[model samples]
Target chain A: MYQFTIKPLFGTEEWELGSTGVNIAFTNSALWMMITTIVVIAFVQMGTKQQMIPGRWQVAVESLTSFIDNLVQSSIGAQGRKYIPYVFTLFIFILFGNLLGLLPLGVLGVHPFTFTSHFTVTGVLAVISFSIVLLVGFWKHGFKFFTLFVPHGTPIFMAPLIAVVEFISFMVRPFSLALRLFVAMMAGHILLEVLASFVVSGGLAGLGFGAIVSLPSMLLMIVICALELLVAGIQAYVFALLTALYINDAENLH
Target chain B: MPQISQLAETFSSQIVWLLVFFAITYFIVGRGMVPRVMDTMDRRSKQIADDISAAHAAREQADKEEEAWRARENENRARAQALISEAKAEAAAKSEKKIAAAQKRLDKKLEEADERIAASRNDALEEIETVATDATQDIVARLAGIKVAKPAAKSAVKESLANG
Candidate 1:
């Protein structure tokens, strides 16, 4: 579908900055990102009435806010409060991104884009989370932050080998985080696209073929659609949880 | 896939928008709204704590008052018991004194009456003796012309009465 296609809505689809190059053109991905941002802002704003007794909308917003609040608090301990805005931003942004992609806006001829399905997008988020961890670790513990690689009770003889392996594993955090979300979202969308193509192809073939292939594909697509919805929320949660966990390691050096 | 093949073209826009939007969410939701909600929760918890402490104080006060009332009730009961015993002792002593005085007066009256009765008995005896002597003298004189002295007759009558 053209929904996944990156077409420049403003400038030429080319990077031509001074040296490193930057694609300054606004695209469908940026549009969806903007939309999700607006939605997040509005949702949060709706809950900020500061009423002693909250209404339904306020409850909905407060639940999400407190969900992240609790997540950070549990994962990062007392230091978690400082990073709530960051972790919350990552969580709600990705969550809204994933859900917005699955909207039935295609029926109205306005196909929704899932920016989080892109490696560039997920990688950026992962990098941001990783950067925060690095900054917090260094600022709090200096070079001693490197001790995060070695387990507390490791034997001195096995320290170097264990340290190397731990170092590699530690370095893989951002890539794994980016890849998990990107692949999960991309795969589900791709499967839906393939199934949709099959439905169309089967319908064009014949009535019997449509019954055999299109009907089952349609049913399967429905099931997969439901599965994808679950995956969307799960992927967002996993991303946020992993980010918080990584931050925990930096904060507590464990 | 355009995601990989066209990454160069779209990466910058995506990253830029992500940063921009994430900043917006961070400022609006995290900084603006969350503190207010937390404050409300804190205020509610504080109110509940204050109410609980006040209720505890009131319960404690009620208990103290009840204990005082019980102590007062016990004191009054003891005082009433003492008063009842004292009144009983006083009444018993008054009644005993009245009985003792009545018994003494009865004994005195019995003694006086016994004396009076003895005197009357003696007078009657004298009269009888005199009469007996006179009759004896008259009879003797009439029958054999013999006369007896009054004192001798009386002594003889008294001796006979005493012997009888």
Candidate 2:
């Protein structure tokens, strides 16, 4: 049951720029990304007409903003204020991307796509965040930014070994960040798909035996869905928090 | 497997969309939404502070007014009490003056009555002495048949009166 597959919705038609060797094609992942963007933008726009006393929608927006604001402040310190917008964007994008997959769009003959389930999507985000850390680290500290890889107060003989290990660990930050989110989302969705297939295949066989057998799997799917919802939010928060921490490391050279 | 094999094909589109959406969200949420929400919160807190201060000022003003009213009431009461005591003292002085004048007039009238009674008593005593002397003189001339001297008769009468 490889129901978790991602396919190009438009049958793989690529638009080429003449003689430029650049092919641009709209994919299902692109569609969800655009939808996520629209939803986020609309949510922000809805909260634009704010009041001294907020309503339900405004309260939601303000709480989320303050939550991220506090996260950035604590993780990245005061200098992290400027990075709030980027961190907030990343959080909301990943959060909505994770949640959008759980919608049952298959009723309309469309397979719902979660962009975050794909490593490429998360990989780009991780690389972007990591690049900012490196760029800001180098920009602020110049050549001293490399000192971040060397642990403090190491023995003279062990310094080289520690430095190499630290450098590798530092470089692996992006891949780890990307894979953590990708695998979490991908695994949950795949598990749901496997359980759902068992229910469907069982139901197709016989009504009496199938219903009894599939009931527990159905309940387990529900439980997994609930857990997925929690994971979606937690992963987004973790991603943003880690990004801020990395930025803090770069800025403060810790 | 398809995701890994077709990574190159899907990579650019995803990145492009991600950039577009993220940039838009950053601009709107960062520049627009966040500031407005923060401003609303700030304004709300400011309004609450102002309300509390205004209430405090009003309470203080009320307390001052109440104190002033109490002080004025106390002053009016004291003035009224003074007026009452002054009126009482004035009435007492007037009654005392009336009683003293009445006593002085009564004492003068009593003295006049005493002097009139003593004068009358003295006149009555003198008359009695003259009458007694004449009676003694007549008795002596009738009984002894000797012409008694007037001075002798008078002296005899005096002696008889003294012995009696």
Candidate 3:
């Protein structure tokens, strides 16, 4: 179980940057994020160079951009277009992370087998979502953003208790958002890698029946993989939506 | 040295790496990726606007043609109305002539009936006069008066009226 679980192939383990109070290191996830950034930049910059009228690439980019735009508009309003860039970026980043994680080399444990289940990645994402919520909140409403926890339409007597509950709930947003996405992506990858190891382990006896039995598992994994893609998109959408909702609350803070 | 040597991919440490990766993605999106997407969207929208404007121009041209057709239709209707009025006048005149001819025929029939009635009236009066004269002659004969014919009685009546 230990051998199957831990695959140390990459030289990345010795090169962790720093440790915090509770003991968390940020290294591999950082590198991958940088890669995700560079990839996103290259994709957009190149996809629009010639910019043919009816070209497939341009249409695709436009379609995605507009889809998110329309979503924001319908959700909040036309005024929501101001936040389109952040939402769009969130979508693309998660999109690459989930997809690139499924890449063979990425799954194979890079540089002395750095386990990709690093919570540092999760925490970082959570913090950003957290920061954005606060930044946008304070930028627009300052102290008023905190009032969202108290909620509206509540009776005066219940206000204090409800406010405390709302505050806790508000504080949990980053954790829930980051945990949901990271858990989903990481779990799906781990399952796939595990199933792949099974097909390799059970040799000749594994050939006929093992391969046949694993067929259903492989097919199930494929379905899950496809579903994971949707989950990835949705998680990103959820994170952005929450941010927007927070921002809208701030903007409408009275 | 012990701490560095002790570095192995532990279950707990993976959480840290996850956070790091998440942060990178968030930052990349926040800084670089989002702006490019927005620019692409703005450009695409501008293209759509240009398309709509071209369509609007074409629509305007069609509208002008439609207006021209409507004007021509109106002019045709007016001309047709004038022609119809002229025809109606001619028709009315011809109908009046025919009606006058029919009235003349009706007057002639009425005059014929009047003539027939006068002749019948004269005959009835002559008969009545003859009968009255016969009755008076009979009465006079019976009471010392002589009998007279219709013509004689009529002459007597005329003579009496002249003398009176």
Candidate 4:
């Protein structure tokens, strides 16, 4: 099925600028990302008038901003206010990226691409957030930042074991964050694609039994799409919320 | 497996696009939209606070004005009451003087009437005494056929009258 393949929209062509090994290519993922950026920028620009009594668009933007602000403030304390921009950017990008894929572009024979469906994009975001946590930790606490690994009330004998466990847990945070988003998005889309293929194949193959089978499949697809929308929002929120929590741990060492 | 291997092939381009788009969103949202929203919220709250305080001030002013008006009305009422009482007292005093003057004149008239009635009674008694003396004298002359002296008769009459 065409839905199962991740083909480059531009026919696998790479624009090699120089010997520096930087490939500038127009991929589907890049196109979707650019669209996401444009959409976000347009939404922000729509609310630029900033009315005291806000209209619908301004209210939407302000609510999202305040939601993220409160999340950051509650999770990471007042010092986390500075990271709101980064967290907000990550949240909106992932949120729209997930939602954009759910749009009915397959009807037009164009498969929608969600940037978050790939591990590489999410991995980059996770790495950025994880790096911020580590850098802020070490910068604020110096070499004692490693103390974050050891449990506070542990016996000296068990301290070494706990530290190793804690270190491993810390190192796996980025991968887990990346995989959680990537897997959820990819799984939901694939399920939708498979169900859609079944509906199409059944509809084309027969007149009575096959068409009746396609009805339930279509209904199930609808239900799954609705669920995917919720998953999209929740996943974005979870990603930002976890990032804030990690930053809090880094700052507070608990 | 294909998906896993796809990472190496698409990693660079994805990273490039991610960085570019993310930076743009970050700048546009962070630098542009956020501050405007915050400003709108702050301004709205400030406007509400100002409205409430102004309403309170206006209410207080109205209360003070009403209180002052009530005080002035009470003072005016008290002054009117005082004027009414003063007029009542003055009328009472004038009536009392008139009654006193009328009482004094009535007393003088009562004394003059008493003196005149006493004088009249004395005059009537003297006339009756003369008439009785003459009548006694006449009776003695006619019935006894004897001539009596006037002074004697008078003395006899006075003795009889006194004894009776």
- List of chain B TM-scores, one per candidate: 0.66, 0.53, 0.55, 0.60
* Sliding window of 10 residues with minimal summed lDDT for model 1 chain A: A11-20
Cα RMSD (angstroms) for every candidate in the order listed? 5.3, 6.1, 12.0, 5.4
Candidate 2 residue pairs that clash: none
Best-matching candidate per DockQ: 1
Instruction: Encode model 4's per-residue lDDT on A46-89: one tens digit a residue.
Output: 76676878889988888888898899999999888788888888
Backbone collision tally, model 1: 0
Residue-by-residue lDDT tens digits, candidate 4, B20-94: 888888888766667776677668779999999999999999999999999999999999999999999999999
Ranking by DockQ: 1, 4, 2, 3
DockQ of 2: 0.38
Tell me the spans in candidate 3 whose CA falls farther than 4 Å from its real position. A1-28, A50-54, A75-79, A106-116, A203-208, B1-40, B43-47, B50-54, B57-61, B73-164
Would you list the rank order by lDDT, best first? Answer: 1, 4, 2, 3
How big an interface RMSD has model 3?
6.9
Q: How does each model score on TM-score? A: 0.75, 0.75, 0.61, 0.78
Per-residue lDDT of model 1, residues B19-86, tens digit only: 87777777877777777766666676688899999999999999999999999999999999999999
lDDT of 3 by residue, A1-254 (tens): 22123323354445444553333334344456556666766665544543535366656666766777777676667677777766666666666665655555744565222122334455555676578667877887777777787777889999999999988887887777767765665666667667766655533355686667567667776787777667766766776676666556555653
Please say which candidate is ahead in TM-score: 3 or 4: 4
* lDDT tens readout by residue for model 3, B1-164: 11123344433344555454445544555445555656766776688999999999999999999999999999999999999999999999999999999999999999999999999998987776666667667776788766666577677755654576
Greater DockQ among 2 and 3 belongs to 2
